[model samples]
Target: MSDRLVIENLQVSYGSGAQRVEAVAPMSLAVPAGQKLGIVGESGSGKSTLLKAVLGLIRPPGVVRADGIWLDGTDLRSLSRREFRARCGSEIAMIFQDPVNALNPAFSIRDQFRRSFRLHQPDLPRSRYTETMLRALASVSIDARDKLGRYPFEFSQGQLQRIMIALACSSPRLKVLLADEPTSSLDVTTQAQVLDLLHALQAELGFSLIIVTHNLPVVAELCDRALVMCRGEVVEDTDVISLFEQPTHDYTRHLLASMASLPRIASGAAS
Candidate 1:
């Protein structure tokens, strides 16, 4: 299959001159259609910055410069901000790390879904919208009728994450899912459940995935290929099995060693 997303010489920097800092050095990557790729890095390794740049979310004083960012043959950099926002969730959706903070505390679940639908499917009738929302929730094993009236604070973290997943996948135009540290805040069993849900949804929907995380086990479980980044640059790129079995970069080896020292916990195990 053709590449679903392609990024070339992507760079991000904050501030000017004396105060400037490079958050992400020049880098290039490609994600083929329906493939899952993991980006593993420590906290300051520019993983989040890279994701933000790709999403066109970088604010003033934080500059994003790239030779090209193409999504299925369309050049993203050429699109206006309004054009980008229109395409964002439908063409490329993002699932943030903190579901609670990502959601509006004052809005009910149905309200949130309505806002999303407005952006992507403004002409959709009310009945159709409700039906679509309910079906999306059901895909993640959530009961829309019972949960739609509740605020973000009412649900457990795991449920909120599942809801976010549902929202991301609801659009028929969705081609790529960008997940940034998506399972970091959840408990062990909930983390496993979310991962399983992501895998199942990807299988059923056929969207490409780019998961940004520091967790090696998460990558191993869900990704076929992995990229290891350190100090604002990609140090290694290899298939998931080879990354763990014979990491070439020193930093990759260190990361593997760190993971090795942690206690082994099976997926879905009680915390």
Candidate 2:
């Protein structure tokens, strides 16, 4: 498969001069179409920072620099702020750790979904937006099509996350989906279901998947390749099996040894 997203010399920082902190060191990676790549790191390891920097989500007082960030042959860095924001969700989408904070509580589900439709298809008929949203909801097995009038607070955490996934993946133009700690906030059973939704959706939609999390089992279950990070640096880059069987980095080995719930990695299935 061809590369859907490519990054070169990406770096991020906050503050200035002596106080300037390097949130993410320069790193490069390419995600091929339909590939699932997991980035594993502890909290503050800069994995999430890397994902945000690629999406240009870092705010003022924070700095994001990259040699290039190309999505589907288009260098995202070349786009204006408006254009870049437009490219997100339409071509590349991100799912956050918590849907509660990620989604606005002020808007009804219908309004939020309508805005998503508008983002992905600027000229999509207003009349079709509702049906389109219903279809997206159904894709995730949510029976909330008619309940679009409900607010984000009305749904369970798992239901809201499924809706979040549907919102992120609804666009046909989408080529890459970046999930940051997507399952960390959910119960074990819900986490499994959400991960399965992500895997199945990626397969059905043919989008490259990049997940950043501390969950080793999630990586083993959903990813083909894994990147182990610590102190804003990649300590190990290998296939999932190698990552589990022959960890090259001391940190990686320690992480593996500490896990109490190791899934059957060879089966290559999410629990």
Candidate 3:
């Protein structure tokens, strides 16, 4: 199958001349249709910047330049902001790290779903909206009928994340899902649940996934291929099994070592 997404020599920079700083150095990668790819990096390692560039979310003073960012056979940079926004929920969707911040506290779950539905399918009959919302929630194993009237603060963190996933996956045109540190804030059990939900949804919906995270275990569990970033560059790109068995880059080895030592350090401290 052809690649679903291809980014070539993409670069993102802020400011100009003496004050300029590159958030994402020129880098490139591709995701095959229905593949699960993970980008692993520390904070400020340019993972988020890469995602923002792909989404056209970078504001002025922060310039995003690329040879090409192709979705299917289309180059996304050719599209205007309005045109891109129109394609957001259906063509490409993002699930942010913090679900609470992504949601409006004042709006009920039903209202949130309505806004999302309208954004992607504005001409659809209002009568079908409720059923759509219910199905979306059910896909993530949430009780939509009981929770639709509740506000954002009414649900637990895990539930909120599931809702965010539901919202992103609801559109029929959704072919790719970009998740940014989605499980970072949840407890271990909740993290596992969310990961399982993500995998199940991906299997059922057949959307390609690009997950950005610092958590190695999460990547190992959810991704087939892994890209390790350091100092705004992709230092290592390999299959998840190879990444663990033999990391080529010194930085990648260090990261793996750090993760490995954490449990021992905690045990020593406790004893």
Candidate 4:
């Protein structure tokens, strides 16, 4: 498969002087079409910052300097702000963590769905737009007629996550899904279910995925290739099975050991 996303010599930094910090090093990575790539590290390891740099969402004083970000050979960093935003929801969308915070509380599900639909299909008739919204909801196995009329609070976290996924997949312009700690908030069973859905969607939509998470089991189940990050640099890039079987980096081995030592959810929580 051809490369759908590419990054070379990517860097992100914050502040100056002795306090200066480099959040990401000269990192180079790529995601080909229909590929699932995992970036795993502990909290504050620059995983989120890396995704922000790609989206051009890094804030002031948090500088992101990169050599190239090519989407199907088109340099994304070269696009104007308007051009980038125009391409964002349509071309590359992100399913952020915390769907509750990410969504507007006041807007009903239907309204939000319609607004998102109109962003990409502005010329479609009202009836067609409604149809599209229902189709999108149904794609994620949501009951559009009943659920679309309800507020975000009416749904469970897992359901809201699926809604976010549906919204991201609504438009045909979406080529990639940037999943950041997507299943972190859910229980193991729910996490497994959502991950299954994510895998199915990737297969159905033929879109590439770049998932950032701390969950080793998630990485093992979801990703084909794994890139282990530590201290703002990629320490290991290998197949998931190989990395899990024999982690080379000291940090990678430590991470695997740490996850291995985590108590069972029920036992840990009961304590």
The candidate scoring highest on lDDT is: 1
Model 3 TM-score relative to the real fold: 0.93
Compared with the true structure, all predictions reach lDDT values of 0.90, 0.87, 0.87, 0.84
Clashes of each: 0, 0, 0, 1
- Cα displacement (angstroms), candidate 1, residue 92, comes to 0.4
- Of the candidates numbered 2 and 4, which has the greater TM-score value? 2
lDDT by residue for model 4 (160-270), tens: 999899888887867888999888888876777778788888888988889998777777777889998887899999999999898999999999999998743322211
| Tens digit of per-residue lDDT, candidate 1, span 1-271 | 8999999999999999999989999999999999999999888999999998998889989999999999998889999877777888888999999999999899999999999999876666877988999999999999878778889999999999999999999998899999998888898778888888898888889999999977787788889999999989999989999999999999999999998887543353211
Residue 123 miss distance in model 1 (angstroms) = 4.6
lDDT of 2 at 149: 97
Identify the runs in model 1 with alpha carbons over 4 angstroms from their true place.
265-271
Ranking by lDDT: 1, 3, 2, 4
Candidate 2 deviates by what RMSD?
A: 2.2
- The best candidate in terms of TM-score: 1
Give the poorly placed runs of model 2, Cα more than 4 Å off: 260-271
Which residue pairs show collisions in model 4? 90-173
* Candidate 3: regions farther than 4 A off: 263-271
Worst 10 residues of 4 by lDDT: 262-271
Determine which window of 10 residues in candidate 2 has minimal summed lDDT: 262-271
